[model samples]
Target: MSAPDTNLEKQERRHKPSMIALRLVIAFAVLALVGFVALQMLGSGDPIAEELETGSAPSAAVD
Candidate 1:
């Protein structure tokens, strides 16, 4: 009985580090995906140029 319990404990200990590493990889992947999406949203510079081309600049002098 004690031998079986020790074997089970050893198996669990062996697998723990691998489980932790897998969780870390998944977390990093999610963070990278979020950062990619954020960059896509924030790095868009073409719309401002389009607005400028359309002459949509606000006037400084108020009549």
Candidate 2:
């Protein structure tokens, strides 16, 4: 009778990320970036709204 190999312990397992999980992450990131840019660019058709402004303005004088 032939003997079976007992070296299965020496074999390494390949690591891989779940495709579904990765797809979800990529989708979410892309959607978030698109939404952010759209909000900033289009201003949601409200010129005075959705404009999260930054920086300082000149001080007005009061006499």
Per-residue lDDT tens digits for candidate 2, residues 1-63, read 765855544432221346567898999999999999988786566433434353344345568
Q: Tell me the spans in candidate 2 whose CA falls farther than 4 Å from its real position.
A: 1-17, 44-63
Expressed as tens digits, the lDDT of each residue in 1-63 for candidate 1 is: 455455877899899999999999999999999999999887656766667778897545568
Could you tell me every candidate's TM-score relative to the true structure? 0.56, 0.42
True lDDT of residue 41, candidate 2: 84
Model 2: how far is 52 from its true place, Å?
Answer: 15
Q: List the residue pairs that clash in candidate 2.
A: none
lDDT of 1: 0.83
Clashes per candidate, residues 3 or more apart or on different chains: 0, 0
Best by TM-score: 1
